[model samples]
Target: MNLSVGITLAAIMTIACYSYLWRENTLYRIAEHLFVGLGAGYSIAMGWNNVKTNAINPLLNDGQYILIVPLLLGALLFTRFLPGSNKWLARIPMAFLVGTGIALSARAAVLAEFVQQIRATIIPLNSVNNILIVVGTIGVLAYFFFSSKFTEGIPGLKYGALVGRYVMMAAFGAAFGNGVMGRISLLISRLQFIFGSWLGLM
Candidate 1:
């Protein structure tokens, strides 16, 4: 409950979690389950608070009748626990949630991935970097063009496609290296926390 005691407890849990690096054991399993349980409890509490403020308060104080629709749909999700044919009632809410989620995701993806990417690619070909960007963008797009036969169609289509393939591979390799670097940074930070804060061996 005290600051130092809490920090010590956290350090112990961290060590228990890292113990899995050597081999699976009781300590690692206990830490993992504790983490999952705490996460679920926190999520439930946050969701409850959100619904009370956003839905219940608005309906009661602001007289917003429209909020009742979403509340009803959310309640219908629990019908999955009911017996027999009534269990199918859960699908109504589930379908609405899935459909709305897909529509929102698709809209955002189009704006961010397609529209913004194309806008960024339309740079003036003045500098060498700009020319390379243009060429790489075209080559990547050409690689995905399955309609035309790259080998037999245009004069330089085959070579353009080949360039695109290499560009994609280079992009993938860079992304992978960046991900590894980020993970290594996280590992180093954790190690520092254990040595400096927990063990006092900095």
Candidate 2:
């Protein structure tokens, strides 16, 4: 393989991506369309290759007859192209796909997201970091306790709500600062590349 050719293609692709910063025009539109088309074409080609290797060639030579089921289901998915007579045929494959996807997501949700998040929240608050996290969590939770009406007579409840509100406000401010910092860092990196690498000033 030619490394120089690969590098040239990568550089061209990078420039195409960055051209959007100027404005949306024919060049940017063409690049966007090319990206989508290339992605779809590559996906179809890979899927076809997988089916041929795993199903078609094997079934033709020595694989089990059960492999025909998936091929039939795949064919059913294309039935959506037919208007009247064969559209219902697509439902078999569609149903199978939805069923499989839901099953996978259900399995992953409990283990990966739900359980892990709960575990992360249940740590001890002995250290300074843990203590800060615990305090923040309590303050935020207190803010949502609707029983604490902001009345003059109930002093403790009012204070709790105030603490929660301030904590939430601080959290939001910190999040915004972090986001702005990230954008500034990206701008700095791009400038570094243009000035130091491209222009060789550094």
Candidate 3:
């Protein structure tokens, strides 16, 4: 529990994790396995502790039988560790998880994605920025419309598609510029750390 000892251990672990950037070596492999082993042990211990507090003590001592179902489901998750006999028991929780996930996603998709996006697109675009958003949305939608072929009979639609292509190119250019700026910023920050913090020469 000593603060200095904990800090030293943390620094060592950080170095060990970063050592993988170099060539493969025994020290890094040992550190990797040690981390995995410790993580697995910690996860198991915490799962057992949660089950004991929420399930076993409540059911046996405090007269709460309601937790048995979830507790049984949680216990079934461990069946994957058993030999070939009862690994199928884990599928119960897996199926439950997939079902719950699908239900949650279906409920969330209506409000967050579909309704909100439609509401946003239908907002008043009286100002310049909102006008730009409206134009961008329309142009992007027009770009994806495949009713009329771009090269075939329609000239006006082709012009609209050409404008949409320009808008897409401009957006992509801005994104690439921002990405380059981000990398430059990171490089500058790392340089500052090396020169200012390490050498006091910045």
Candidate 4:
């Protein structure tokens, strides 16, 4: 009984969400608002649970006073609600959060992007595929040189930059196609759910 109700509700929501294909109507607005509200509520719940488990519970039960520092910084996040100069309190934690995030991400990004790319590109160019890979990598870099001297004044680099432009175009086209395919896949799944789960048609 409950399963049927859930499926019915899902089918209704799916239809409501897709109703914007015809025109933006009240049904689409309601579905959009409901989705936003649910997302916000879920985020709040998850954040509260995280704080309780990682900070509050540990501090209270184990007398871990160090957790109070983070808890206080987190509380500073709410100070954005205050007026005038007081709102600047939020900037303290915000700066810490941004700096920490950038520091951690930059470390990982250097390994993933620079180190991995270099490792991948430095392979022995014995085969045709390896040669293409190396050439393509050089071409892409040449394309982004920005200086006319390096990209155009240099003969080989000029051609490499042209190849790079085509390579970038192909990559962007592939990405766009993948995005379209993903949307189509979602539509197919929703249609299957509406027919098979709700209507028992398939």
Positional deviation of residue 60's Cα in model 1 after best superposition, in angstroms = 4.0
lDDT of each: 0.90, 0.79, 0.80, 0.91
- The TM-scores, one per candidate, come to 0.83, 0.64, 0.62, 0.90
lDDT tens readout by residue for model 4, 73-162: 999999999877799899999999999999999989999998998999999989998998998889999988876675347678778888
Residue 104 miss distance in model 2 (angstroms): 3.2
Q: What C-alpha lDDT, on a 0 to 100 scale, does residue 167 get in candidate 2?
A: 81
How big is the positional error of residue 103 in model 1, measured in Å on the Cα after superposition? 5.2
Task: For model 1, give the 10-residue run with minimal summed lDDT.
Answer: 1-10
Candidate numbers sorted by TM-score from highest down: 4, 1, 2, 3
For model 3, residues 23-105, the per-residue Cα lDDT tens digits are 77777887899999999999989988988988899999998988889888987988999998899999999899899999999
C-alpha RMSD by candidate, in order: 2.9, 5.2, 5.3, 2.1
Candidate order, lDDT descending: 4, 1, 3, 2
Q: How many pairs of residues in model 1 come into backbone collision?
A: 0
Candidate 4 stretches with Cα past 4 Å from truth are: 1-3, 149-152
Model 3: residues with Cα > 4 Å off, grouped in runs: 1-3, 79-88, 138-202
Model 4, C-alpha of 10: deviation from truth (Å): 0.8
Per-residue CA lDDT of model 1 for 35-120, tens digit only, reads: 99999999999999999999999999999999999999999999999888898888999999999999999989999998998999
What's the C-alpha lDDT at position 201 in model 1? 81
